[model samples]
Target: MINNSKILLVYTGGTIGMIKDFETGALRPFNFDELLQSIPELKLLDHEIETVSFENPIDSSNMNPEYYLKIAEIIEESYETYDGFVILHGSDTMSYSSSALSFMFENLNKPIIFTGSQLPIGDLRTDAKENLITSIQLAGLKKNGKNVLSEVGLYFEYKLYRANRTTKINAEHFQAFSSLNYPALAESGVHLDINEAMIKKANRRKKLIVHKELDNNIMVLKLFPGINENIINQLISAKGLKGIVLETYGSGNACNEDWFINLLDKAIKNGILIVNVTQCIGGSVVMGHYATSTRLEEIGVISGKDITTESAVAKMMYLLPKELSSKVFKTIFETSLRGEML
Candidate 1:
């Protein structure tokens, strides 16, 4: 392996790599050959840089586990040669993609930083340059002759957050992502400020294990005040469903109805793993905290703690293939396989 720091820039197509078509007033993908030509400042960083562009870039909305696996494949294939990776992605599903990657790469020891712009790079006032440049700097960052930020992260609006902890909170703002329950891994200002104390330091001794078996045979059941039995029963009875992310109210609270409880209880007994995640953004799921949630707890609904819905779905997809027993599955789901929850 090469000793010097080498950062691989992977462009899978996003607003950050687009240029405007003045004639049509539309955005177009910029070529990889023009990457360095567009950003000469990259030459100033004290690290070797390489670029890899997908044949046809995907919009973030079109993102799925297949693409997630493809990203994991890219990182695995280049893991030895590159010191770190910077993924250019669209903001719309950036959190979902980043979260999936976090679970996909086990024992990761290099930064896989995802970043993109709300505005196209060709725009005069674009945020793409700043986000991309700083992300590269972060990917190349080292301390005591070892990599810094050895985990999946999303860098936007000057903050680098744990990938699984983030959620896309807005569409029109430069600061589009938020990790409410987790502090940023790093912040960029006049200088890079990595909160070393909170960093999930890598156990470099273990080999990286890339998991590609993702099962999307799951559904998200978000509860509201007037949600009825017809809707709940139909979903709980999904023909091939393997799991359900029950987006409950505060502290994993759900409706206190006999029919709802019966539907969920039957689903769990029939091998559907139900994970009870709070719909609120910033709190943990205290399963039996109130009478409303107590029924869910008694019915063996898995508590998602403080895990975000994005991460919850990713976790279910990643873990369900193991086919652990009902009790074992619930135990593992409550545990922090990745640092996705408290």
Candidate 2:
């Protein structure tokens, strides 16, 4: 065991940090000082564990790019001091935050594992203890004297997935997240098993560059039967809109109507980036596979391939502030910048 490894546990507010008050039966936030008391098993782990929490813990639904930048700055400031980071975030928007972090950092050489539970940590059958403990263990994993994981990851329900490839599938279930288009990077059962071939290798020679600026002037538009032009036009013409994640039908098929095509074309022509991702939980967007999607490809709509909407949004936000030209942006978005797409 690598007992010498040091890990920073960042509690950014979620069910994992909540404890039920025995007297009132009301849930209240617990200080990290008592973390050892609640989860005594953590003391058994060989690695050194330290914790930090947000001044005002927030619900995951309230998460935004500003908080995303805050998380990145925390890791950036302590990048060299700690071997790894374990973030306790709300499961609802965990994927979004994790995906955003994945793109905000370049040449990352340590694991940034995000985790949270469906139930409060004080609940009798809560999954918080297991999730918290295993995440720390994974973060501290070392091979050849180097960190085993070099990319952002989310660990839950005995599985660790590439953060950008994951989505919250169920709110009520203990197993809340899924990476439909990607495989688990690691799985826990009787033994800790890691898929060595699936991990993203980092360029350790390069210095880590943390990007602070993120543009959130984006929105997701889902296509459905009987969708009209009025709504679409309003969104496209909305002031300050920079990008759109169009959740199209199977395999990125859209309405294909002249009105639909013209609206999207106008958006792209006006410098708005449109990313075509599928509404299905699993499957890649193969533009031009169908006649409906063909026009989208011809109109300069970037194919999201197998990337999730969560990732597409984060990638868009990360890329927008760079001020890349339309041509450069299209090429980079289509390309797998962080192993987000095939």
Candidate 3:
């Protein structure tokens, strides 16, 4: 058994940290330092708990890379002091932030669990208390004197998912996130049934390396019926656009029209990396599957097989502007990094 495990609770603004005013019936930020007062059950946990918050809590819609860096800095500053971290963030962009964090921390050896609730924590029927309580439990979990969850994860409702593979699927339901291409690492029911085989094993000997350089000069071009050249051109011609995520039809197919191919080819020739991903909810992007997709493969478009949009964006942001050649970029994007793509 591990001794003296410390879990840091980073509150970056979300419904999970809000309390409803009795008089006005409005939600406001609760004092995270007073966590025990709000959730007395936290005292039952087996580890020391600490709290940190953003100076000015912004909604998740306003979340950006700067805030991401701030989180990384906090983790870096307390890396040796804490065994794990639980981040409270808004559900709307939780997946995006989690995905970004997965790429930011290389070779992580501790849990960085992101969680939030659909309702404010102060509400009687709110799901925040359970999520917060379980997240803390998961963060402090250990086996053989080491941390159990050593990678970035999202724990919600009853499932714990790899951060990069998750997406927020519900606005009104308690289970707001889903992992489309992966299995849950752990499930909370009568007990925390951990899928030990599914959990990512970390190399504890490796020192933590934080990657802060992210290239954001990229655009997502989603294909739709009757999409004209003008619309395509506008997206491709965006200033300083260095990469494009071509959200294609089934099996990575798009309009076989020469106009479309020419536009894509020109973008490729101009040194803009184009990646083809399926728009379907649950299928791999299989380039060259049909005549519709053959042109994309022939024109040097890379396939992002079985990767979700959130992972694709995070991968691109982490990869682009690096010293990689076009050929190398395609190879890496198609290859599985951190099990984001199968």
Best by lDDT: 2
List, residue by residue over 202-251, the lDDT tens digit for candidate 2.
89899999988999999999999999999899989999999999999999
Write one digit per residue (lDDT tens) for candidate 3, span 1-342: 343479999999988889999899988899998888778888888679999999999899999878888998999899999999999999999988899899889989999999999999999899998899888889889888899989999999978899898888889999899887799999999988889998898998898899988888988889899889998988898889999988998889999899999999999999999988888766788898899999999999999888887778888988985858989999999888777878
Cα TM-score per model: 0.97, 0.98, 0.97
Please tell me which predicted candidate would have the highest TM-score against the true structure. Answer: 2
How far in Å is the alpha carbon of 121 misplaced in model 2?
0.8
Candidate 1 has its poorest 10 consecutive residues by lDDT at: 1-10
Candidate 2 — which residues are off by over 4 angstroms?
A: 1-3
For candidate 1, give the lDDT: 0.90
| Local distance difference test, candidate 2 | 0.94
Candidate 3: count of backbone clashes, pairs at least 3 residues apart or interchain: 0
Q: lDDT score of model 3?
A: 0.89
lDDT by residue (tens digit), candidate 1, 216-240: 9999989999999998888788789
Better of 2 and 3 by TM-score: 2
